[model samples]
Target: MNKSELISVCISDNRVCPMPPQWVKFEELLSEMGNGKPPQSLILGYWFDTSDEEKRKCVQQQIDWAYERGLLDFAIEYLTQLKPNQWHTGYRK
Candidate 1:
């Protein structure tokens, strides 16, 4: 699907944050990288006011999860760029 369609799916499925105003750009970025394909593995979560160690652990978990799902490129290129306050993982099958 196209970027707009992907974004719509993400919203409809509650795969990403429900904050449309904020996440529209993020979904667009994912759609661009996906090149019209949907991700096989998508993880979305949030953390707040955590210790550095905890943040590291969360990040590592995201990486490990994406890698095991064969989404290392997406993990490195997109997931790693996310802010610590939120988590997003996506990988093409």
Candidate 2:
């Protein structure tokens, strides 16, 4: 999908562009880096980062969003449509 289509999908399905909340946070982080909210500056000596937490939250949000959008079964059905040949146990003498 092109940018426009993807934007529409996210907005309609996820309620936000890109749908992943962390991506939105990440964008904010970048926007703040210049203003002094940089991760490295915050952690200093720690490895803990909000990015990981944000990512997990975003994944959860995506799951919830997809479920709410009723796309889970649709996606499964779509994939099912692509199912390859099924095999049954059979042998010829």
What TM-score, computed on C-alpha atoms, does each candidate reach? Answer: 0.35, 0.27
What would the per-residue lDDT of candidate 1 be over residues 1-93, giving only the tens digit for each residue? 333333343333223332222234434544455454332222234333433344334344434444455555664455334454443323222
Which residue pairs in model 2 clash with each other? none
Q: Looking at candidate 2, what is the lDDT of residue 79? A: 22
> What is candidate 1's local distance difference test score?
0.39
- Output the worst ten-in-a-row residue range by lDDT, candidate 1: 13-22
What TM-score does model 2 achieve against the real structure?
0.27
All models, RMSD in angstroms: 13.9, 16.3
Q: What is the lDDT for 37 in model 1?
A: 30
lDDT of 2 at 90: 18
For model 2, the superposed segments whose C-alpha errors exceed 4 Å read: 1-49, 74-93
Residue 89 in candidate 2, Cα distance off native in Å: 39
